[model samples]
Every structure is written in structure tokens, then in C-alpha cells.
Target chain A: MPASAPWSAAVGQGGGVLRSVDIGALELEAGGELPTVTLAFECWGVLNAAGTNAVLIQHALTGSTHVSRGDSEEDGWWEGLVGPGEVIDTDKYFVVAANMLGGCYGTTGPSSIAADGAPYGSRFPLVTIRDSVVAEARLADRLGITSWHAVIGGSMGGARALEWAVTFPERVRRCAVVASCAASTAEQIAFSQAQVLAIRQDPHFAGGDYYDGAAPTSGLGLARRIAHITYRSETEMEQRFGRAAQDGENPLHLGRLRPVVGGSFAGRYQVESYLDHQARKLVSRFDANSYIVITEALMSHDVTRGRGTLTQALTRTEGVQFLVAAVSSDRLYFPSQSQELAAALPGDVKVHNIDSAIGHDGFLTEVGTVGDLLRESFFAQ
Target chain B: MPASAPWSAAVGQGGGVLRSVDIGALELEAGGELPTVTLAFECWGVLNAAGTNAVLIQHALTGSTHVSRGDSEEDGWWEGLVGPGEVIDTDKYFVVAANMLGGCYGTTGPSSIAADGAPYGSRFPLVTIRDSVVAEARLADRLGITSWHAVIGGSMGGARALEWAVTFPERVRRCAVVASCAASTAEQIAFSQAQVLAIRQDPHFAGGDYYDGAAPTSGLGLARRIAHITYRSETEMEQRFGRAAQDGENPLHLGRLRPVVGGSFAGRYQVESYLDHQARKLVSRFDANSYIVITEALMSHDVTRGRGTLTQALTRTEGVQFLVAAVSSDRLYFPSQSQELAAALPGDVKVHNIDSAIGHDGFLTEVGTVGDLLRESFFAQ
Candidate 1:
């Protein structure tokens, strides 16, 4: 490995080299076990003598387990905040972050080989958020740990944590649900559907079987562009970008970041660059099939299934202590939804705040506050 | 025209048979001009003695000028709420409801012709909400009206009213802005872009010139489905359509009201049908070029342009009486944005409310309360 490489054993963060570890053919949901399945995970920090301080970090829509640091400068995603004595304090907790069931990364998603050795692609069956949690449950059991000190996440990860508390009530002692809602809002599902369709419609997508041909990068880029806007707040965009123009760059050409009038055929905005970066990064590590797979999973997240409704979902999680927080600027999962989630979970779960200029992405970008909340929530575990 | 058609001139919606009014090339920030423009308009009541009572009824996105006539078996969009003794009280006001510029209606849009008489399609220039108001100003001038008693609308139309006050302050005496915001949120634009791309990706789209072929109707249907969720609230959907299956249709089929598992190979949700209706209606009356045109226009509605910063945008509108309202259930344009808008445009500018189960779309669906607020905003003109 190169000297600048991050820890390859665990994650693709901080310039870390990674190797795929399959958790083959995981069973999930009421219907039956999927004929074939896989789980992808990356880890940081050390497990203590008691082996009791484990934290399972969940991800949001279009996210992976690369929460910072890889083998190179381009390796780490959230490395600025999740390592050493950083906000997440990897030095203290054995952080176990894994890509969900329907995710890309090294997981068995749409890009994974089917029984026929061909990509599952669109042929992959739809997955629910609960199924993702169920797969994670199998991973937890395999890790030889009866219980986790805490299980937490933001956005869809938050949805998984809620499930952890309800479906497997005893598996997680302390739960932190961040910037998420109790149920997928129709508006949210609608938006997710649009993103999925955007990717699916790319000519290069080839109906999700583009393994041999070109990938639907443009469609994926457009999808990421659309989603990136929601991840940020207006104030932050105003302060960070706000119609600012890139100096000396042709507005009509690539890498242009300003609103140049009468410049050329296609003017570029800095915002567009930002979105393109996000989309490119995602497509590089994430599979298009997994993108659709996970999105569909997220849209199906609901705690009220076997349980009657939200109240029942909450009531079912009797003894689980939880920490509920939301980004101040989050638009996708409004802070109110977090508040509602807190109200719905068992026993007046303590609500925390991560005040950030970024919207839903605060959980990833503005990691300091989230780290601090995690610290407080850890003790509650 | 059919007796059920609400759009007929016989219904007194517009002055003459919906005339084909040519529009200018709309300049866009995203690097393209919506080259061709057409506008559909209808005027009801009379242009009284002094022509001072014109209330320009701005329709929401996906809405048209047939606000009160039942042109089909379907009810008029704003039926029972804008006629003779209705809240808008056509008995007293001369209402001029015109399809905004860049719209898909009889107005000039993507489906409209270029100088060569071919559909403008992908060659359409970008049009802004402010641009729409500018185009409306031309119509106002054509009718020799110096000022309007009131300019009213909800959502997109509400945006127009605010622009009218800023651009033609002397011509707009009273403005009623309801369930709207000062600017489009990043979330708002993200959602809109997703819809645009969804339609663009359909293989049948054939670039922007799909007028003669399959027309990418499926993609448009999906886009409409996405937009509909944004327009309404989760609470309303839950109350009205949640988990409740249609009479005989399975959840997977297009006819079902609620989504069902294993119902169709296409994964068509009942909500998908609703979207198809919206997209189909638009396809029939609107052009794909118009969708891009108006959407681009909406995305660029930064009232602060040339006024310095955001504060300046409000400062410039010192004499305007603004009514900033938002649906309690609205998630796309949070009520918080409305608060910001109200604070920015103060004095006689007040913040109103439309408590509904619907989300952002509460602006249109919850008529009674919204109508009351409208009357209060303009003091019955």
C-alpha cells in the first residue's frame, strides 16, 4: 500500500484501500429470504476488552460506509470528522459502519453477480428499509456481539435505528436518530422516485444492465444535482456560493461556476460543479443498480408494519433509550419531523441539535455538532 | 367544444377563442433561450368603465386558466370557489386568468412554433417567474389597463403577484400572495429539476422534438406523480388515500388509489395515475419545451436581482402590501421560508395561514380558508 493510504482493513475513507467482505445470502422480511444477498462494512477505532462499546453507524440516501479516510486524498469521505479525536471520536468507540443491503460500495447490490454470474441490475428485487435492517441484524449477530452500545444514523440510517429499536428491541441499547422522520413522507418518496427515474432513464442505463456498456453517468449526475440542493440550506449556499462566479473561466464551458450572461451556449454555475462532484463521486464508488435498490428501500421505510401505527411502533420499543436530533437547516427531513420522531419513540427520548448552515447534509459535513451529540447519546447507552 | 369544457369562450373565461399570442425569447441563467413563446388567456366579467378592477388570477404550477368552468367530467380546478357568489366573487371583479408565459396551455411554450413553424421543443429559452410577470405586463398593456384592483394567486401565481409589485409597483394596487414564499428553496428546485429530467429521459422523447412520436408520456407521468406529492401534504394523502386500496384495482396497477405490493410489474402506484393525469393534461395543452421554459423561469426568480442582496430585494418593495402565507403541512416550501418572506416584506405585508392536511399544495386544495385570507389580504379590493 502507498504511504498516504488509509486503513484498508476497514473502510474506503482517508485514502484507505478496501477489500470486499461478503456476508452472503442474508435472509430478510416476512416474504422469505432473498436467494442471494450480501453486506458491505467498513470499520475504524479499536474494540475494547469488554467488546461492549460498538457503534453501528447507518447511512442516508445515496451514502456509503466511507465515513472519512481512504488510501489517498480521494479516498476519505467524512475523514475530517470521524477519525482520531475528531467529533465522532473513533479513538473511543469501535465504529462499525456498513453499506446497507440495497447499497453499492462492496455490498451485493444490483451490480453484484447473480446466481448466473451476471449483474442483477433491474432484475434485482425491490428491498425495504426493514430488509436493510434485517441484513444488518445478521451482520451484528455474526460479529459475536449480543448487543451494541449504540446504533445510530442520519436520514435513512435514522430510519434503520428506529427499526433497531422496534424490530430488534434488545439488539441496540442506545439509539441516536438524526435528521430523520418516523415515516417516509409522500413528498420525500415522490422526490426519491424522481431521482430513481432520472437514473433509470439515462440511455446509458440500458434498463439497469449496463455492466458491459457505458454507465448512466449523466442521468446519475442530474439526480445527484437535484439531491445535492436538498442536502444544503439556502443560507449556507448563499454564504458559501450564492451566485458567485468563477474567475477567468468560460461560463459556457466546463468548470465555470458563475452566472455569466450572454457568455456562450451553456453557462455553468458553481452549484452545478458542486453537484457534479457529488454525482461523480457517488457513481465512482456506488453502482447505478444499488442507487435504485437503496432508494426503493428507503421509500419503503416504516416502523408501523407489524406494529399498528407510529404509536405502536414506538410502544413496541419499550426499554430502548434513544437520542433524537436534527439539523437546523434540514429541508428533506424537516426538524419538525425529528421532533415528531422524538415524540413517537419510547420514553421521552432526549432530543439533541446539530445547528448547521448545511441542510440534511449537516450530519456529514458539519460533523462537530453531530459528534458532540453522539458523545452525549453514547453515555445514555 | 364539448358542453362540459370549462375552457370555452362561451363560458366567459377569456375574451375570445383562446388566441395564440406570440412571446419573446426568454433568456435563461442555465445557458439557453426558450426561443418560441405562446400564451393562453381568458377574461371573465367585464373590463369595467375605467378598467381598474382587473384581478390577475395567477394559477399555481400545473394549473391553467379554466379555474371555474367544468370543461370535462372532471371538476374545474378551482370550481365552486371563484364564480359569481364564490370567494373570488366574479360578481364584483373583472378577473383576467391567463396561462403564464412558457406554460403548456394554449399559450406559447415548447409545443409552440418557431419562426419556421416547427415546435420550439428543446430550443426553448429559459423563462423566469419575473419574466412571466413581464410577459403578463404586455398583456395588461394590450388591454390598456394602467393598474389592477388586485393581483392574486397561490404558489407560482403568488410568486407573480409579488413580482408585479416590484416590477410594476404603480400598476398593482393590491396583491394577494398565499401559500407561497419569497424565493424557490433549493429543495424546491431540486424537486422541479428531477421532474424535468424524468421527462427528458424517456427514449421516446427524441430530444425536445417528440411532438410527432410517443412523446415520452410515461416519463411525463412519473414527473407529474412526483410533482403531485409536492403539491399536496402527507397528512392529506394519509387521510384521503393512505393504505386504502381502490375498489377493485390492485396496488401495483395504475387504477388503484393506494400503492400495493406485487400488484404490477411496472410498480405503478395509484398515485402514479394521478401524475399521469397531470402530465397528460399538460402534454395535451402544454409542450415539453414549455415545461422546461417555465421551470427554468421559476428557478431563476431571485427578486433581489439588481436590488443588491436579499435584503435589498425587500427594501426595494417598500410600498407593497404583501400577504405571505404557507400551508402548515407544506414540506417542500417550509413555513419558515414564508416567515422569512413576511419579515422581509413587512408593514401592511402580513403572514397568513392555510391550515390543511395538504402539504405545499394546500395553496390550491384548501379553498375556503385560503379564500378568506385572500379577501382579508386585499380588503375585498
Candidate 2:
């Protein structure tokens, strides 16, 4: 294969050329066989002769492979954290990001067509964090990269990065886990369960097989609304929206006095309106089944599953350097969880603070701070 | 009116005999008329001469007038806190608990028969915290209680108590607002909006007019699941449920490999089971329309709504003794918000802490501590 393949015209912007390579059928963690698995990925910079300068950047739930404005004008979620002259400088290192296995962004997911040429939909088996890491290792092998200098991600992405270090300790030299934990806490599982039920209970969901219909947009939107609240901090929500009414809409008097069947009241508070907007955006861009698939996979995230204690689970990663960080205001992935993850690691790793008020999403929004931390720790020139 | 009418036998575990008095028509704050409002209440102990010893205890959202197991074997939600020999000392203080106006507990609510002889359903107007207070004040008038010696409540109950202090300053001699804020924060409104949406989206809900058909149990259950999470702290949930799987159920292998339309995977985690249990309990006992109405009322719980500022809104309560307390582990109603409320009070009020690891529900669970605080402050012999 050539050093770089032509960009696939499937999805995403010019962060890098979107490409896919079939990783073949594999047994899933839960039980069932995915006859064929196609992993979609994007890359920037060139792999060095030694192939030792490679870095894998994992994306969070609902995140695409686009990491920066590489060849495309569209800014990535972590726009300033990568690319030329950036902290994870493409000029000095070959950076790659892959769409997670149970995702919709050009990856083999619930929305992807199966061997029978029908959308997998609810037929897709449960994909765990370990399974995704296994698939990514194959992608790395196909790309001629024997080892990665570092694997970095935050939130669900952070879980993926941590899984990579644990599952392939010999392959990842360094790993950075930000705003994530070794396992999903009960609260995390509870929140995700609510999201899943919201979609399932949607009239249009039709189980997870609604791809051929109207696509449970309402359910998906409600799920996003619930998830968006978790992604943000209470103080941030209070300060930004407060109890102010949405402009020109008196939540007080907008609804019908005698509401008819299938009719409901409009959101009166600015916060409600804000949540509605967030819900709408996610509903439009993402696929509902993909959301459920990825969310459940995250809910099943336990680095210690079947592996004794957290310390025992992380025993294999002794060879990999670690960077564990947490957002100060994050309620979803509490900072204390980061401390727990760091404490169980092999070395005396210190948990770093992101010093952000943006909550769990701080890992993505605070690009300057994230870049600064990366430069000082892993990519120091 | 008789000292105590026959027990209405409508709802609630026996405390005081549940009795209803038609307060007549009520003009609601949100631009609607509620024709013939019937306020349901239960009282323990006889009213003292001059009615100076009457203490009104407001129930929280979904809570009934059963503040104690008075005349029945069934226990009340706040059973130990208010009884013949308890903190409030029902034997000495004529303690009364009223089911809030948009409540399902024999109160004039969405499920109640309207003037037209049909269930109100969706035609029920939005009842604010102040409106409930007004209706309760009328109940007090019918019972010949000139002024309440003290008015106490927690959570949404606390909001009602605070509103009483502000809306009818002279009527309440002392007010205790526990586990609540002066106004509903933006985050509170956002969470509530999701809940309302959850119920509204239920196909069987039929726009809140489903009283004639199947109840929106699924939607109501989802709403309860969402609310139940907020009612407890993350630490409590983590310590209690963790990621342990439910017995006899492998969340991993329970779902259909090829999921059919409308099918869903069973909850695998103990936390999910806990939430489901909570949902089932609420769905069995509560009305979905009542849940929406009461939740919206709580969402509209700003004491400063029409009033200038929080301080200005609370300016009328100068003569009313204030006891502002917060659950130390509460994420739903933060201690800082309690502090804010205390700081704005006329006197140098100190916010008390109901220190418990149980989170927001600590106000209910830590009854011993709460009773102690009440005895030391308001009900001291």
C-alpha cells in the first residue's frame, strides 16, 4: 500500500483523508459474531522510517475522527490541540484517529450495512472498549506501525486510550487518560440507562431498527438533552442561563389551557431552550442506534472486568508511561475517579487538574490548557 | 365544619383523617381559572385555643398529607419526625399537613373531577407554589387557624414554606426551609424539562389526557428514573450499586442478537435495577399528569419571580424566624444555595447542615438529626 491513500468521499471534513480497511469478522465481548468489521480512520503527518513516531488520538462518544483542520477548512472538535505546530505536532509525529467500532461516522456500526446488504440496526452486537482497542491494533498493523509513541483521549476517548495501554501494553509507549475512569460508576450507568430508555421508548425507535423509518429523532433528541446536562456543570448552567425566560416566550403562558391529544407545552426557561437546541443538533447529525450502541459500550467500561482489582487490571501497563487528568468541575466523570485511576496505576502517577469550569466537556473545550499540558508532559520539544 | 370529617379514603397511608374542603374557585397565577378548588389536608392533635399553636408542615413533591402514622398501622414518609411524642410533638402542637394543589393525593389536580364532571387531565392549569400556598391559607381559614406558629418543609416542600413566608409573611411566625433554594436554578429547570418531555413523549400519554385510557406508565417510569438519580448523590450510588450486575441476568447476553422492532435489552447493572425499582414504585402509586403538573410548579419555584430581587422578595419575612438548612451531600439542592438564601434573610441567619452520606434525600433519611435541629431551634420545650 502507498504511504497515504486517497481520501474517501464518505464523511467528515479535511482533517485527514477518511479511509477504511476491513478488519474481518470477530467474536464480540457479549456473545455473537460480526461477520465483517470495517474500521474507518483518518491520519495526518507521515510515518517515519522507524515507524516509532506514531500517535493514536481517540475520540469521545458521538465524536468523529476529525481532530483538526488538516487539509479541510472545517475545524475539528480539538482544533488547536493537533496539526502543524500544535502540541501533537503533525510536523514531528504521525497522528491517527479512528471512528470507534460502534460509531456512525464512516465506521462499521449499527447504521452500517451488514453482509445481507441491510442496515445492522439492532442486530449489531455489543461492542466493548476492549473490542475497539483490538480492532484499532489491527488497523495499526495494516498501517505498518509497530508501536505508538503515545495514545491520548478524554472522556469516553480517555477510556479507549486507557484500554489501549492495558490491552496492548507493548504497543503503546505512553498513554494519557483525561476526564475518565477505570469503570463506569453506578451514577454513570444510571444516566446512560436513562438515555437508552429514552430512545427505546420513542414511538419511532421501533426497537433499534428504525433506520428505514422516521428515525427516533424525538427519542434521540431527548437522550441528547439528558446527556448534555451531564456533560456540563451545574454552576455553568446556573451562571449562563439562570432562571431567565427564553426571549419573547413566557414559559408561563405558552402552553394550551386544555392541551389536545399529542400536544404539549413549549419550553419556557432559557435553560430548557438551550437543552432543546443541544438535542436538535445531536439528533440531526448522529444516528440513534449508533448512540445507543456507543453509550452501552461506554456503560460497560470497566478496566477491571474479569481482571481482579483495578491494580491487577492495570498491571500489564507497567511499561507504558501514564498521564491521568480530570476536569475540576466535571460531575459526570468526577475528579476523584481520576485520583483512583492514577493511584492504581503501576508508577506513582499524579493526577493532573484541567482547571476548567466546563465540567466533563472541559477535556474537549479547553484546547489551550490541554495542549499546554500535553506539550509539558508528552510532546515536549 | 366538623373538627375532623370522615377519612376521604382517597389516597395516602393513614396519618390524620384525610378531609377535603372546597375552597371555591381559584384564579391561578399563570393566567387560568381553576373552578372549585378542593384542598385536601390531614391534621394531628386538637387545635389549641386562640389557634396560636397550629404548625403547618408542607409535603414535598409526590409526598402526601401523611406526615405521621396517626390513626393507621401504615407508616408515613416522615413518620418518626412528627407524632405524639416526636420533635414537632403532635400532642402539644396541632400539626397539619396539606397535599399541595396540583397533587394527586385527594387534592384538586389533573386527575380530579372538574366542574364539568370529567377528569381535569390536560385542561388543568399550571399551579404555582404561591397558588398552593394561597389554597392552603384558605384551608387554614376554614380550620380557624389565624396564624401558623411555624411552617416547615423540605425539598419542594421547603419551596412552599419559603413562598408562604414571603407571600403571607404575617401568617407564618417561623419558617424552616430545608434542602431547598429561594429559586429553581437553571440546571433544576433543565432536569425538570427532560422529565416533562419524557412523560409527554410516551405514546399512551396522549398529551396528558390519557386518564380515559392506559396510563403513561413507561413515560412516568422513565421520568422517575431521571428524577431519582438527581435525588441521590453520585458517591452514594457508587458506594451502593457500583457496577455489579443484577442477579440471574447477564446484561451482556440478555438482549436479542437480532433485536426485533420495539424490543430492548434488560438492565444488567445493579444501579439500573435500583432505578427501575424506583420507577416501578412511583408508577404504581403516582399519576403521570400529576407528576408533570407538580414538577412544572416546582420548576416555576422562584420566590423572586415578580419581586425585584431575592433579598427584595424575602423582605417581607423580617418578623418571621428563619431556619435555613441544607443536606450536606445534596447535589440537587446545593448547600451554597441554602447559604445564599440565609444570607439574604433579614437577620444574621446561619444555615444548618443535615450531614449525611445519602445525598439530597438526607433531609428525609436523617430524621433524627433533622428533629434535633428543629427541637433546638423552633420546637424547643
Candidate 3:
């Protein structure tokens, strides 16, 4: 029995081995060797000796390669999908989930050690989704994998998958890009800029070098709050929280709202409280510098960069088919983006929509539906 | 030649006299009387020996009673319309423009000294558009005016004019509500909430009591930036500025953007400079606290408050004639608001559309067109 606590989040699979492996030396695209890098991962099921049935799982923003059981948490992320004889079928396939580059987890990220022996932090070079894919490809190469049974990711992970298909097409035979888009919208970029500003403007930030001291938790929390609002629908927010006050205190300082008379409380709105919680959660685990780096990467996820047109950029990939899915209620990565991606691919690739009121987060919550789709896609093989 | 400079903006005629008055020991609506108050006003012509020919002009958001003329500056903000013998015809009728109740300039506002001798700031009680109209009515009563020739204003100012027609229907003979809606839209309120948050969240702001030190300039600047963006169209912004960068040092960085790729200090985005100028101009003349108050006031301009349905709200007035108008380009005070107001208005209240590319600001621009519309509406007199 695993000692890990149960977290019924869709991705959590009950039991899995949490481990880290040093992938030896990896050569970066910039011709630098990153030595002694351990790719932290969580594995579900037996390797079946030959390891030919390996499945690579990608995680989203603020996610980890610890896709299943934690040290003391039995209800693992992706647990439902990866249990014995489940959709991911732990009994049949070995699932390896690895953290992406520039992530704050055990992966080589802004908090990772640089050659100079200091945290990469702000000095971490800007990373593109392609760069993350390249790093992951190196990990794949180290695992003695010339080809994979399948690769999957949602959100930023999905962007990485798209990049993987293009950068190392022959390796990823099948890919699932969920609740994501081929290109970040200008609106997305604008919001990302706001988050960047929020973090940099925090007096405690100290130019991203305050690692030994206070991190920019306030700004990071605010950034997370801002992003969290966008991740859900306005209608949902209104219905769920509306104008209800958090505390009895009126922000307006007019005492209680008094209904038709007056409104009060500074942090009165329930939504504000919701945001407060979300922000706090982010501030706890996310690093300020890593937040900036990862957000910029997300914003710069345009495959069409320097490739002229999207079609041209997409054409660079020659391997596996893809399962393109977008959350129906997602305003950020609207279903239209999925249609565009599907349009760009060869051979009438099917476009799927997950009807969700949860907005962009539907992919994280509607695991059953997503799992079913994954099962169908994999079963077809 | 008048060395003191006429309040009038016209070269050949007077926009009006820019004047001030002291209303001491006057009772207020909510309670006790203020010890002393000074009101700045502008007049198109003489109040007339009989004072019966006076026409009151209400200004809108970011507008003052200074509808025309400046002692030093030749280009008064409203120079395009109000003039000696312009459409309002200062030669025939006396026109009076009063700075609003909660304004920043010379009039009382959040920055005004309170009974305790400190800036009202956040302590200023929440006042609505109706409150504004009531305050103006008091000004009229103090001026010994039984009735005005017409009450005219656009946008929020227009909302005030509508309140005059409904709250004191008999007090207003002719009312022109331009570039405004009957009620604020959910979308409009949402955007305003965002802007308010932007200002309040500024680190420099000490809970609306920044008078002792630096103001929330960054937050206010961001608020103005948002408003400015909404005040213009995407097409216009694209045509006027596009993604061009401003000229600066060899490698200037503006939130991740610099001048052309040539690496020379060539220039910056034309739009960026425009936004910068807009922000700076506002920062120079406006107080953040007053901005908070007025923005909140505008946000609270709901015609459906206390009153019955919108139609019933209009019916509350015993007698009045109304003219409703909205700018074609206005996204905030959408043209549909004008239509709704006009539809609910009993009798044949005329509705006019002022065509301009400047959006809601068009009510302050396209002077020739608005002047013409004003003339037609008030011509019945």
C-alpha cells in the first residue's frame, strides 16, 4: 500500500513509483552539455522487461512529471487513468511521466544549478517550447527509446507535444494535444505581459535574485489570481461568487452592504477570496523567475515562428497522427484553435470538443471523458 | 480685447465667461452644510439681465465645466463647438457650464477638504449620477434660476441630463442626453471594475490616502491606458499606431519590445507613445482619489435603481421633452443604450447618431456635427 495521501484530481492514479534518473550528459541545442541532470519522473505499471510498451506522459503548466503517486499521497495524479486494466492500462503499458524543462520541479529549471554553481534563476536563458521538446527528446534518447508508443500532454504540455512532433517526429508515433492551441493569441500575450509586470513590480522581487531570501510570492499570487480568473468563465464566476462579500466587513467602509442602502468591505467579494486562495496556492510552490520563464515560453509557443505561415511550420513534422481537442468553454484556447490545427494536419484528422462549463480547466477536471478519448485513440492502434 | 481672456473658445465670439462663486454655509443632501464651497463655471454669454435665457451645459467623463476658453491656451478643449455665435448661439441665449459635484479641478471632489480638514479621498461617500443632478439643481437654485433653457450633456454627463429630466422634469425645459445609455451594461461595469482594481492595487496607493506622499500613479496610468484603448477602435489603433516602436537609446526595452530590428535608436511604436502621452497627461492633471470617486460614480450610474422598471423610471417624471444621442464608435456607452433610453421615453423623443471614428470621445470631438445636432434639438425654442 502506498503511503501517499489521496487527491482525487482526475490525473492522479492511486499507486505509482516516484523516482528520479540521471540521464547521463545531455547536449543542448546551443552546443552546451548539461551534466548530472536528473529527470524526475513517476512511473505506473511494470516495464514488461522489453520496455517496448512505454508511454510518455506530458504535464501542463504548474504540473509535474510526478503524474502519479507521491511520497505520501496514494491518490496520484492521473491515477484513475493509469490503474490496472484502466484506460492507460498500467497492466499493459508502462507509463513514464517526466517533468518538462524550465519547470520548477526536480527538472532543470530556473531554480536548477547553472555551470557557475548558482541557481539559473533570472540568468536562465529564454526557453521555447521547442527547446523543452529538445530536452525531453534527450531524455527519451537516454532511456534507450528510439520510438515511443504514444505521447500526451495538455495545455503547455500540448504545445510541447506539437513541438516534439516537429523536432523529433519519428520518435513520437502518436500525440494528444488537449485544451491547447497552436498559437497563443495576442490577448494571451497581453495578459502574460501583465503577469510579468506584476512579478517584476513586486518590491520583494529584487530582480529575481532574492532566492536566498523572500520570493515574490505576492506578485506571483496576484499573477496566478489574474490567470485563474481567465481560466474560468465569467458566467461561472458570476454565478458561483457573484457580488457576495467574503468577510462581513465592507470594502466601501460603509459597514455592511445594507442592500439597497450601501455596500462595504475591501475584500468583500467572494470571487476575490477565491482568487486569494488560488494566488496563495501558486505562491507556495511556484518560483517567481520560473513563472516568468514558463509564461514567456507559453506565450512564445508559436510554431510558425520564422516559418512564415502556420501551415509551413506544421508541415515540418512528418510523424504520427494527433488527437486535437479543445475545451468547449475555453475562451483562452477556443475550439477554433483546435479546428485550425486539425485543418493544418494531413488526412482529415478529427477535431474533438470537450463540452465543459469549467472553461479552460475542463481538461483537468473531465478526466473520464478525456480518458475515454485516449482509450479510443490508443485502442485503434 | 479682454486681457483676462474670455471663457469663450471662439475667435469671433464668446464661448462664455469662466467664473467662480462661493456658496458658504450651504446645507448638503445627506446632512450638515459645508462651511464654504467654490464652484468654477463657464458661460457662453451674459446670464442676461432677466437670467431667463440661461442654458446649462453638463459635461461628461474626464470633462469639466470648462467647455471653452482658457486664459493662456488658445485651443480650449471644447473649442470645436461652443463659440460666440456658434450653434448654441451665445449671441441669442446665455449658456452656463458648471464643474460637476465630484470632480478634481476647482470643484469639490475626493481631493476636496472635508469637515475634518483632510482630503475626502476614500472617505468621500459614494455618490450617484442622481446625486450629481441633485447637486447641480442646488447650484441652479443658488443661482436663482427657476428653469433652464436646456440641460445638455454627453456620456455620463448625458446620464446626468436624463436624471434632470426625470428627477425634476418640470425643472428642465429641454434635455439633450448624448452618447449615453439608459442603464449601464454588465460588460461596462465589468470593465470598470477591472480598471478600479488596477488603480487600487497600485503599491503606491495607501488606501486612497496618498496625499501625504506619492500617489498611485502607475495604477492610475494603467487605468488610463485601459480607458484610452477602449475609447478608440482596434481598426483605428491599428491604422494609427500598429506595432511600431518608439525611438530611444540603442537598445531600449519596452515590456519586451524595442524599435525596429536595425538595432538603431530609430523609434518606438507610435501607439505606445500615444498611450504614454495619454497616461502622463492624466497623471499630471488628475488626482488618483478623485479618479477613484468619479470612476465609481460613473460605474454606479444605474437608471433602474430605486425606481421601477426602466419605462416606469421615465414615467416618474410628470413632464419633460428629451433628446437622446450616442456616438457611432462608442463601445462603452453603446448606441443601443441610446435606443433603449429613447424607446422607454414617452412621446416622440428624438434620437440622433453622431458619426465619428473617435469612439465615445466623439461626443467631445466631431464638434461641427454635434453642434448641428444640438442646434436641431434645441431649435424648437
Point to the candidate with the largest DockQ. 2
Looking at candidate 3 chain B, the ten consecutive residues that score lowest on lDDT are B250-259
- For model 2, residues B1-381, the per-residue Cα lDDT tens digits are 543432221233224677778899999888878888898888887676577778899888889998888886767787788777788887777788999998999989999998788898888888889899999998888777878989999999999999999999999999999999999999999999899889988999987789889999989999999999999999999999888888866667627233434333554688888888899899999999999999999998999988998899889999999999999999999999999999999989999989988899998898888888889989998
Model 2 stretches with alpha carbons more than 4 Å out: A2-15, A254-264, B2-15, B254-264
TM-score of chain B of each: 0.83, 0.94, 0.86
Clashes of 2: 4
DockQ of each: 0.23, 0.63, 0.16
Cα lDDT of model 3 by residue, B173-211, tens digit: 888888887765544554555556556667677667778
Give each candidate's fraction of reference contacts reproduced: 0.19, 0.74, 0.00
Instruction: Identify the candidate with maximal lDDT.
Output: 2
lDDT of 1 by residue, B19-105 (tens): 445555555434555564556776665555566767788887777877766233444566666656666666666677788876776
In angstroms and one decimal each, the interface RMSD of every candidate reads: 6.7, 2.3, 6.6
Q: Model 1 chain A: which ten-residue window has the lowest total lDDT?
A: A255-264
TM-score of each: 0.80, 0.96, 0.74
lDDT of 3 by residue, A98-209 (tens): 7776778777777888779888665565555776777777666555555667888888778887778766777878888998878765445545655664676565676667
> What would the per-residue lDDT of candidate 2 be over residues A107-133, giving only the tens digit for each residue?
899999988889988788888888899
